[model samples]
Target: MSNPTVSRIELWHFGAPLPEPFWPSWIPGYPMTENRCTMIRIVDSDGVEGWSAGPELIRERRGLGDVVGLMLGQDATDIDLAQQRLREVGYFGWKNWWIEPAFWDMAGHRAGQPVWRLLGATEGGEVEAYASFGEVRSGSQRIADAEARYEEGFRTVKIRVHEDEDADIRQVTEVAAAVGDKLRIGVDANQAWRVSAFADAPQWDLDRAKRFADVCADIGIAWLEEPLPMDAYDDQAALNEYSRIPISGAELHTGGEPELRMMIERGCYSIYQPDAIFTGGIDQTRRIIAYCKEKGVTYTPHTWTNGVGFAVNLQLYTLSDRDKPLEFPLEQPSWIPECRDAMITEPFIARDGKVQIPEGPGLGVTVSQEALAQYGEQFFVADA
Candidate 1:
């Protein structure tokens, strides 16, 4: 039989409320609301435990207990196998990709190492960050907001553009005109991805994306992110060939490397953004970065989900090229460090618009037990 000391896995829901409804303008018609949290707990054969979590809409995970407990006793070192088993759970109802990262954490502790070192990267990188705006305001308001953000120590920005093409162009042009050479600019159509909650969300086909690309080109935009539907592989490939600036997408793709392989072969995005949490686990993302570098395609990690998700993406971001700017999500009051990252003992803060990668164990970010008590609800746990 296998060594079986810590023989179960637990999934907990941490019910917390957002200060206000942080309505994403990109979502078109979804109303504002609070955030419910879900944290993943994994136990090793030695009883050493690890945790990871994501932002949840509702505190409803009824069947995760069945999947996690049985997943124990298998070789945690085998990441590929772990992913496969997670897929097996899809036969039921849950999407178990979140569990895959915990396996890496367990494997790291077992090897007496950190996850970054386990992934074949050397030193951690000091990443330059872009102030990515979550709310897409009216054109006049957007310009004022962009200026305000610049005053807040941001040298670069990526704004949401899901409105009419002409209006978006005018707004972007004004923002660029005001910032002049003072800032680097990027626009996200928020089209490639949309949330179908209770309201209608706009969709961007290839024709619309191409038309928008023309405006981005005229106004000296840096790069456009997620312009077309993410899986419109052929459409993205065609856009890259004809666009002025680089076309980037695949933040929430099924398999980015395989898609990236096709993109590179067909010449898609000049830059590739794959969130380690939302995409796949670190190993798959790890491969995508190397592949991008070898083929001269830029790679940057999207770190906007939660503190742990941000931390995980940050470690990966540091290992990638410094030339590739990192996305540090900072929409304050409702979505700032104190709240969006309230659970993390020490949330990420930018020093002159840059973040330093820690040389500590694991992902180098700490979680606060006090904050956990205030915000986290322990739903399940495994014995020692």
Candidate 2:
């Protein structure tokens, strides 16, 4: 059969209001009121539709017409050409790597297979998950939350820390004591991609990371994530060597394969977490996963964006041989499964702390037209 040609493209500014205000630890004092993203839909000549999304703080992609023009007549299954087109767009302005997944989604649908199977997975099944908390709360409240997660069948949980040295150490110590050995705990410093746009965020130096690592080691913490800046290659390598526990980061690196390869060669982190949407889409991320296997580095992806972002990464995660649990972004009252996956026909809710891999064609989740009518605003549409 001939390759499917792109026949139409559409873009929408999608936003789902949160039930309550959510103060993300990465941004310090900013109150996030909605889950916002730019959604894209690509329809081929055969009428098979593929979808993808990118996180957005505002409607900054109103000028995406030029990018859409480049994809108008190209073969939707020719991902190499798709990557080249996206890279060409990056040369002039924003890194639009997030949009590349739509090609994979399109190809998977045409082949009548899941994205993971298209990427070479033998079978489709469920994968373990760790409850990833987004905010820093009092130690007492965190302990209660941890216990609740444990009850829900999550064997592991990741907490946030953004205070002074003493307070940070105390927070982990208290939670570790509360859970004992029943739960494995991980701590995210959120320093790799720090956001100071709305308020002052804490910055971590080598000394501070070392001190925190020492406490985490004593408390048997599973891993410490993004303890230093994303570009601090030399410091990250040094800290990884110094720390008794495993060090992990690299989400939203935006440098693609070459930069990630350099870090792997430098022994930057024991574990490498690259979200496919933010890194360089599925193809580049697959290369990163193979490189991690060759270098003996752990490869688990970051899945904190919206439902589409999570689906994109979940497909990539199945290609890895590593057994690390996928990051399941869950925070109560605000970033729940329903709101995060408002557009998806079936929300990816974790049962017993494990999410069943979607078995449908393409990215495996169906986009809800009704929900789109409710939450998405169509901003651009074009036909070849």
Candidate 3:
């Protein structure tokens, strides 16, 4: 039988209405009213299909289907060639490794295995969940949210810290007090990749970062993330050696595996987080995992994009060390599970602070046509 070749590619611009405006902790006061992404679907000659999604501000990729289709129309089983072609396209046009995972989704389907098993996960079970609150709120509001998550069975939670050092200290103190010693707490500085779309963001130098790291140590934070800029390798390495708490970051780095490997060699962080969708796709992500294991560093994917993004990272997280809980983006009234997973057949929900790994072949997900009709607008479609 001939190897499966891609027959068609479809791209959709989908947006789900948010219950309330959401301000990302990183980008301080920008109120986001809807969750939007450019969804990618690839169908092979054998009729097997795979899907993935990438973040989008508007329908910017409406003209990309022709370029993407011409480049990715080769054999779907040849991941190496597909990656090479995608990278080549990047040299001239857009380099979206985000779309690369859809090919792996097809490969997994053809083999009748989940991506984790193909990536070498031996034991099969659910991964631990951590409530990752996206916005910076008041001490009382933060405490209430943490308490609600604790009641919801999440044993670990992460909160964001903006500019004011006093406010940051107060927020952590109140939440820690209410949740007690029962929950593990992590803090995200969001200094890794700063966005000033709405309001001016805080800029932290090494001295300020060290000061905050020292305060986090005093306040008993389990881990401190993105205290410095993402590219601050030397300072990050020094801080990792100096700080009492574990330092984590590098989720949105565009440097891919080479830079991550350098960070490992330089002892930049105690924990390494690289989103498979945002960074360099599955191959680079798998390489990063192997390097972390070899160098005795912790590895967990950053899953904050959308439901399809979360599912792609979840598959990779299942093969990780699981020393730290997987990040679950949850904020009430806005970034809830329903809105996050608006395109999928079923929204993923946690039970007792854990999520059952989808056992179906491939990424274990299917797009709901009803949801597509409601939220998706087909912007691009091409047949090979």
Candidate 4:
């Protein structure tokens, strides 16, 4: 058996222009873009590599130099320690959440199994994907595009309602009028975490969120995600109570354990979508899933960051037996896996609009280092 040692921790940034700009219909004030993924890599003692990534804003970690060394030579096999180290570094404004998948990779390698198998998940099950649009567009355009999306294997879709109260009303009205019964729609407030780097991203007020919730309910929408900021526990709880459909939040909360514990107590989400990367790490995500299961809240890990980020969280998503659908962020030309995951070989092929559980070893993801060499810009590489 391999004694799983942490020989190297590497971070790579690889981005490609999107085929076209995609401004989500919901993020009212954001601009569309073609910029794509920035990846993460981790190699264990045995020379095995595992990869993950975040989108668009690449090279954010050019200065990870002063930090990654803390993980050098540690037992990658000891996931608890790795998770702790990652969480501890987060206190100083640097988020090492993307590195959490490294521990799962090491854990799987040491145990001679795929991470999913080790987590007790069954392979080859199809997970339904919702068409999560990234471009901001009008209600008529949304109706036409969503109609096209239905033919493209998506039974459900998520659109951004970017602070246009009346426009939001029109969009929902069109959706219910056009295909509300045929397709289930979920609106993403995306207010859980704001991306202010871009100048046009619209911010949502609490009143707008509540009003939107009323519209969502009136339209027979399936669920509403992140209507308020992720930490606004009281507001989230209150909205969840009155919202006709399910209420959900918690994507970029790096405070992790404590924040999730508080949300669980306050019943902040009917469905808690914690991104494994943005959270503490794999073990901490495992804890979140356990809590959700115990509390009867649906457990669907968020996967919108990038391809590898999707792959890492998919393993965690399979661990829960909620029998609920998972979020497989696929919206045509702009955010499909082909472009969102262009660097990877088998970029999660969704069949008839659903993805199957992976059976391969590690996180069931393999990155072509040669491809990384071609497109990836190595920002941080630590080996001892």
Candidate 5:
């Protein structure tokens, strides 16, 4: 009758190879050939396994076992305790928020309800999906891609733009013309977490962001995301006030509720996109969602990490009262659903540009043992 306690934990470093190299606009010039993540499986005393994953470029979490040991034997359904434990782990300079969802998964299984329901959703249903392109491609290619997405029934599409101001404006203009009124467009500057290690990445100032926002408004952009750095609260607030279109960001912001609350108070953005994995997990993200609702700000999560990350956010997105479509990370050949979700039994494929909510309990994620054996290496295991 008591809550199930954590009994065992296992971790794997998975690298699912892509069919082709993926050029992510955020981390310019880096050729990502694998969908890499640190996969965690937590089994409660009741023998129900909960799963979660964190994005990784390497086995950097080799020492995570020592940290995760903090949760062994704790109440699996006590998310507050789990969150506190994760925060303690962070004090050691490690952001392990991504692992907190595994506890929610366990609680859902124990209660015989999906995670979304556990989080207060009245019912389960499909959510509209926007095709989120990961690369900044040529104008012609981007137009073709938008056309293809329209054919696939995606009424909304988000495109990436980086570097040169003129080139970025041109790309958005061309794609807008190609799709016209057929698809609503969102533009991501990828300026929140700028990566210039491999190649030069442009850093946007207030002047540039204002100019871009004007252009986006003229071209009918639905939103402009991350126009300034994540911490630029003052500038972001000014830009949000100055722009005609909505401004959104905070996807990977690690400052948790306090930081997000400050942004909300400052009117930093009209829309807040906090990915559960990066933004202090589900519990904290839910708090942010409530704040956004109270402050009249739009709340839609960023779900570009991977299948498991997507599943975690999907469960949380169902809690939102807004009708915005979820961000469906879909770049061609390299970052398609097959490769993105290779570790899970089912890939989230959008049909008519909408993905049905998973009905199963515990995050609705079923890890594929076969795929795990093929694409993952077991690196850590512990028992209570």
Candidate 6:
């Protein structure tokens, strides 16, 4: 049999309804009632399909299917070449890093192996999960939410913080005092990137971040995430130098591996959390993980997006050292698994705060055609 070639590329826009208004800590004041994404599907000549999703994307990729076909209509197994071509395509247009996962998915499917196994990882065991809440509630509400999660058997929980340092301190302090000894606590400042499009947000200065880091240290917070702006390398380095907690950022870095390497060299943060889909997809993420290991920095994936996005990052996470718990985005009633993972045939179920690595081919999850038909509206298709 000949090598399988990419025969077509398709794009769909989906808005999966939620049970209640979900609030994202990153985008303050905006009540999210639906999980939205632009889905990418690549088909091989043999009719095998591979899929991925870009979270919260609008019609920005409407005209890019033809561009993708023009650039990537070749052997489906040439992942490195496909990645390079996709990088080149992004030079003049948008950085379509989200589409790159489909290439890896296709390659793994053609090889009859899962992406993680293709990356040289032998096992597909469970990874420890950290409860990642995405709302900025009152101190009491936050404490209650965290306490509930702790009772549910989560060993670690991450809370969001913003605005006045004292108020932030109050929120974290209450939770830490309630369950710091029983749980590993992480505080996300949400200061790295602000969503000013919807409403104004608090921007943290170096001094503010330093003060908060000091507070986290006093409270025994395990990690401080995005306390300073992502590009605030010097400031973050300064804070990392003085702060007792591990400083983490780069979840939404646009510069890919090279920029991440530069940040690592500058000592921007002690922990590097790169979302594979947000970065340059799987291979680039592997590069970041390997580099972080070489530099002795902790690495964990940012898995706040939908199921497919989470799966893409999870595959990369399985290849990394399990030193830190993987991010498990869990906000009840609104951002539950049913809606957060609306497209997958089965939702990711975590028991005792641990999720088993998928053992299937490619990204290890199958997209449900019923869910796709119910929520997704296909707008672009291109045949090779």
**lDDT per residue as tens, model 2, 247-361:** 9999988888888999999999999999989889999999999999999899999999999999999999998774899999998878899988887888898999999988888
**Angstrom error at residue 11, model 4:** 2.5
**Segments in model 3 whose C-alpha atoms lie over 4 Å from true places:** 92-94
Residue 152, candidate 6: alpha-carbon lDDT: 82
Q: Write the per-residue lDDT of candidate 3 for residues 238-348, one digit (tens) a residue.
A: 999999999999898756788789999999999999998867888888899999999999999899998888988998897687889999999997999999998898888
The ten-residue window of minimal lDDT in model 6 covers 64-73
Q: How much is 342 displaced in model 6, in angstroms?
A: 0.3
Among residues 3 or more apart in sequence or in different chains, the pairs in candidate 1 whose N, CA or C atoms overlap within 3 Å are none
Q: Clashing residue pairs in candidate 5, if any? A: none
The residue ranges of model 5 lying beyond 4 angstroms of the native Cα positions read none
User: Candidate 1 regions off by >4 Å?
Assistant: 1-6, 91-94, 110-112, 382-384
Kindly provide the TM-score of model 5 when superposed on the true structure, using C-alpha atoms: 0.98
Residue 103 alpha-carbon offset, candidate 3, angstroms: 0.7
**Whole-structure CA lDDT of model 2:** 0.90
Off by over 4 Å in 2: none
3 or 4: which has the higher lDDT? 3
lDDT of 1 by residue, 41-145 (tens): 777777655667765767666556756666667765667777777667766664555567777667666666667887777876566888887777666776776
The TM-scores, one per candidate, come to: 0.91, 0.98, 0.97, 0.92, 0.98, 0.97
Each prediction's total of clashing residue pairs, residues at least 3 apart in sequence or on different chains, is 0, 0, 0, 16, 0, 0
Off by over 4 Å in 6: none
lDDT, candidate 6, 292-338, per-residue tens: 99999999999988999999999999877798999999998799998
In model 3, pairs of residues that clash are: none
TM-score of candidate 2 versus the correct structure, residues matched by position: 0.98
